[model samples]
Target: MILRFSQLIVGLILFGAGCAVMVDAGIGLDPWTVLAEGISKNTGIGIGWVVSITGFLVLLLWIPLRQKPGVGTVANILVVGAAMQFTLPLVSTPDHWIARVAMFIAGTALVGVASGIYIGARLGPGPRDGLMTGIHQRWGWPIWAGRLGVEATVLVTGWLLGGTVGLGTVLFAVLIGPMVHVSLPVFDGRARRRRHTTPAAAVGGLSAPGT
Candidate 1:
C-alpha cells in the first residue's frame, strides 16, 4: 500500500512536470493542457489553477456517469497542477529548435511513464481519464473512439480559444499511444506477468487488486 501510494504521488508529480516541460518546449501541449491554457488566457487565472479547476469540473461530470472517485483520483486533481506550478518556474524553453524538439519528446515520454506508474497503482483514473473510459463503457464505444472524440473536441475548442498548436501537437498525437503502450508493462508489474491480459484489466478497471 505504501509503495502504491508512493507510485501514485510520484507519477502525478512527473506527469505535471512533463506537461510543464512540453509547455516550456514552446511547441505545443496535450489536448487537455491546451484547453487549460485557453481557459487561463480567457479568465486571467493562472494555468495551474485552471488545471485544478478543470479537473474538479470534470469530476462533476462523473456523477451522472456513476463514476466513483478514489484517493488517487482526488490526489490527481490537486497534485498534478501543483506540480506543474512548481515546475514551470524552474524550466525554460531552449532557443534552438533541436533542443526544443528534444524537450518535447522527453516530456511526452515522461507523461507515458507516469501514466503507467499511476494506473498500475490501481487507485483510480484521473478526472479526464475517467471521463474517457466512462464514455466508452456507457455508450459502448471503442476506447480509442471515446478518447479520440474527447481529445479532438478539446483540441478544436482550445485552438478556437487561442491556444497554441503546432508540429508538436502532431507529434504528440502520433507518439503518445505507442509510448504508453510500450511503457505500461514496464511499470505495471501485474501486467508484465500475463501475456494475454487485456489492457482494460491491466490498467483501466475499478477492480484493482489490493487497492
Candidate 2:
C-alpha cells in the first residue's frame, strides 16, 4: 500500500511536470490541456488553477454516473495542477525548433509513463479517465469510442476558444495511445496480482460487481 501510494504521488507529479514541459515547448497541448488553456485565456486565471477547477467540476459529473473516486483520484486533482504551477517557472522554452520538438516528445512520453504508473496502482482512474470509462459502463459504448467522443468534443471546443492546435497536438494524438498501450502491461502487475488473488471477481469477469 505504501509503495502504491508512493507510485501514485510520483506519477502525478511527473505527469504535471510533463504538462509544464509540453506547455513550455510552445508547440501545442493535449485536448484537455487545450481546454484548460482556453478557459484560462477567457477567464484571466492561471492555467494550473483552471486545471484544478476543471478536475473538481469533472468529479461532480461522476456523482451522477455513480463512479466512486479513490484516494488517487482526489490526490490527482490537488497534486497535478500544483506540480504544474511549481514546475512551469523552473522550465523554459528553447529558441531552437529541434529542442522544442524534443521537449514535446519527452513530455508526451512522460505522460504515458506516469499514467501507467498511477493507473497500475489500481486505486482509481483519474477524473477524465473515469468519465470515459463511466460512459463505457453506463452506455455500453466501447472505451475507445467513449474516449474519442470526449476528446473530439474537447478538442473542437478548445480550438474554437483559441487554444493552440499544431504539430505537437497531432503528434500527441498519434502517439499517446500506443505509448500507454505499451507501458500499461509493464506497470500493471499489481492489478493483475489483485485479480488473480481475488478469483471470484476474475471469474465473473467484466460483469462482476466492483469490476
Candidate 3:
C-alpha cells in the first residue's frame, strides 16, 4: 500500500513535469494541455492553474455520470498542476529545431511512463479518463468514442484559441498508446506480486506440512 501510494505521487509529479517539458519544447501539446494553454493565454492566468481548474470542472461532470472520485483523483487535481507550475519556469524553449523535437519526444515518453506508473497503482482514474469512463457508464458510449469526441473538440477549440498545434501533436497521438502499453504491466502491483511469488513460496503458504 505504501509503495503504491508512493508510486501515485511520484508518477503524478513526473506527469506534470513532462507536460511542462513539452510546453518548453513549444512544438505542440496534448488536447487537454492545449486547451489549458489557450485559456491561459486568454485569461492571463498561469497554464498550470488553468489545468487544475479544468480538472476540477471535469470532475464535476462525473457527478451526473455517477462516478466516484478517489484519493488519486483528488491528488491528481492538486499535484499535477502544481508540479507543472514549478517546473515550467525552469525550462526554456530550445533554439535549434532538432533540440526542440528531441525535447518533445522525451516529454511525450515521460508522460507515457508517468501514466503507466500512476495508473498501475490503481488508486483512481485521472479526471479526464474518469470523464470518458463516466460517459461510457451513463450512456453506454464506447470509451474510444467518448475520448475521440472530447479530444477532437478540445483540439479544435484550442487551435482556434491560438495554442500550438503541429507535428508534436501528431507524434503524441501515435506514440502514447504503445508506450503506455509497454510500461503498464511493468509497474502494475498485481504483476509485481505475481513475479515475486516463487513456486516454493506458493507451496509454503498452503497447509501441507504437519503442524
Candidate 4:
C-alpha cells in the first residue's frame, strides 16, 4: 500500500491546484489558506511564497512523527508553493459578487479534488495535514480536534499577521471534509478503489486514503 513517487506527485498537484483556485475565487479560502494569507502579509514576499514557506515548515513536522519523508514529501515541499505561484496569475475571477461566489464554490471543490488526490496517494503527508496528524498522536485527540487545534493556531497566527479570515474561512472548516470525502472516490482510479474498499473511513469524514 506504499505510495510510489508518481502517485505522490499527482496528489501534490491536486492539493496545490485546489489552493490556487480557492484563493483566486476570493470568496474565502481554507484554514491553511488563512495561514498563508497571514504569512504573506508579514513576509511581503507575495502570498505564493508564504504558502511555499509554510508548506515547507509543516512538512518538517512530519519528520519527527517517524513518517518516512519520501518522494511525496519532497513533491509537497516543491509543488504547492510553486503551483501557487505559477497558477495564481493564470486563473482569476472577475470583479463581481456572482463571479466571486461561483469562483469560491469552485475553489472549495478544487480543494476537495486536491485533498482527494493527495490523500488518496497516501504518501507521507502534506505539511499542513502532517501538523494535524502530529497533534492527534501527541495529544491523543480525534482528527477533528487535532485539525481544529492546528487550524485555529494557524488561523490566529495568520490573523495576527493580517491574513484573510471571514465567512469563507468558516465555510472551509464546516464543509471541506465532506467535499474531499465525496470527491476522492469519484476521482480515484481503479487502483485507488481497490486500495480503499475496506476501512470505515471517517476521520472527521475525510481520513486520508491508504494511510
Candidate 5:
C-alpha cells in the first residue's frame, strides 16, 4: 500500500514536471495542455492553474457519467498542476530549435513513464481518462472514437484560441500512444505479479479477486 501510494505521488509529480518541460519547450503541446495553454494565454492565468481548474471542471462532468473518483484521481487533480506550477518558473525555453525539440521529446517520454507508474498503482483513472471510458460504457461508443472526437475538438479549439500548433504537436500525437503502450506493461504491478506467478499458484489456493 505504501509503495503504491508513493509511486502514485511520485508519478503525478513527474508528470506535472514533464508538462512544464514541454511548455517551456514552446513548440507545441498535447491536446489537453494546448487547451490549458490557450486559456492561460487569453486569461493571463498561469498554465498550471488552468490545468488544475480544467481538471476540476472535467471531474464535475463525471457526475453525469456516473464515474467514481479514487484516491489517485483526487491526487491527480491536486498534485499535477501544483507540481507544474512549481517547475515552470524554473525552466526556460532553449534558444535553438533542435534543443527545444529534444526537450519536448524528453518531456513526452517522461509523461509516458509517469502515466505507467501512476496508472499501474491501480488506484483510479484520471478525470480525462475516466471521461473517455465513461463515454464508452454509457453510450457504447468505441473508445477510440470517443477519444478522437474529444481530443480533436480540444485540439482545434485550442489552436483557434492561440495555442501553438506545429511539428511538436504532430510528433506528440504520433508517439504518445505507442509510448504509453510500451510503458504500461513495465509498470503494471498487477500484471507483473501475474506474470511472475505460476499457473499452479493460480489454481492452487492463492486465487483472489484481482488474480
Candidate 6:
C-alpha cells in the first residue's frame, strides 16, 4: 500500500511538473498539451477546459476499446488538467531566450520523469495513452500502429484547433521515451523496498486487508 501510494505521488508529481514546465517554456509544448493550448488560444476557453475536453473524449473512445475505467484513469483525466490550469501560469521563464530554452528543456525533462513514475506506479495509464493501448488490444492492431494513429490524429486536430507544434513537440517525442526508460527503474527499486517492509498474511500469503 505504501509503495503504491508513493508511486501515485511520484507519478502525479512527474505528470504535473511536466505540464507546468512544458507550458512555461514558451516554445511548443507536448503534443496533447499542444492541442489544449491551441484550443485555449483560439477559442478563448480556459486551459483546463481544453485539457478536460480532450481527456474526457479520449476516455469515451476507450470505452469502445473495452478499456474499463479505473481510479488511475479517473485521476489521469482530471489531475493533469487541474494541474495545468493551476500551475502553468506559476511556472514562467525569464525574458532571455536562453532562459526560455532552459525552462523548456527542464519542463520537458520533468515530463519524462513524470511519465516514468506514473507508469511505474502500475496505476492505469493516462486517458490518451490508455486509449492507445485499448484500441490496440480491442482492434487487434500493433502497439506502435495504435499509438501512432492516436497521436497523429490528436496532433492534427490540435494543430487545427490552433496549438503550436514546434521544437518542443519534436524534442518531447524523442526525449520522453528514453527518459521513462531510465527513471522508472529507480522508482521500481523504491517500490520493491516498500513491499519488502510490508507484512503479508501468513495463511494465504496475501497482503493484509487495507494494506
| C-alpha lDDT of residue 121 in model 3 | 90
- Please give the lDDT score for candidate 3: 0.92
Instruction: Name the regions of candidate 3 deviating beyond 4 angstroms.
Output: 192-211
Worst 10 residues of 6 by lDDT: 202-211
As for candidate 6, its clashing pairs are 14-114, 38-162, 38-163
lDDT of the candidates, in the order given:
0.87, 0.87, 0.92, 0.71, 0.91, 0.76
The worst-scoring run of ten residues by lDDT in candidate 2 lies at 202-211
Go through the candidates in order and give the clash count of each.
Answer: 0, 0, 0, 1, 0, 3
Give the per-residue lDDT digits (tens) of candidate 4, residues 75-100: 78788778777778889677987887
Candidate with top lDDT is 3
Question: How should the candidates be ordered by lDDT, best one leading?
Answer: 3, 5, 1, 2, 6, 4
lDDT of 3 by residue, 9-125 (tens): 999999999999999999998899999999999999999999999999999999989999999999999999999999999999999989999999999999999999999999999
lDDT of 4 at 157: 78
Report each candidate's C-alpha RMSD, comma-separated, in the order given.
Answer: 6.0, 5.5, 4.6, 6.5, 3.1, 5.8
Error of 4 at 123 (Å): 2.2
TM-score of predicted structure 5: 0.92
List model 2 lDDT by residue over 21-112, tens digit each: 88889898999999888888898987887888999999998987889999999999998988888888999999999999999999999988
Off by more than 4 A, model 2: 191-211
Clashing residue pairs in candidate 1, if any? none
Return the TM-score for each candidate structure: 0.89, 0.87, 0.91, 0.79, 0.92, 0.83
Q: Per-residue alpha-carbon lDDT of model 1 for 94-134, expressed as tens digits?
A: 99999999999999999889888888888888999899888
Candidate 1 Cα misplacement greater than 4 A, ranges: 196-211
TM-score of 4: 0.79
Off by over 4 Å in 5: 197-201, 204-211
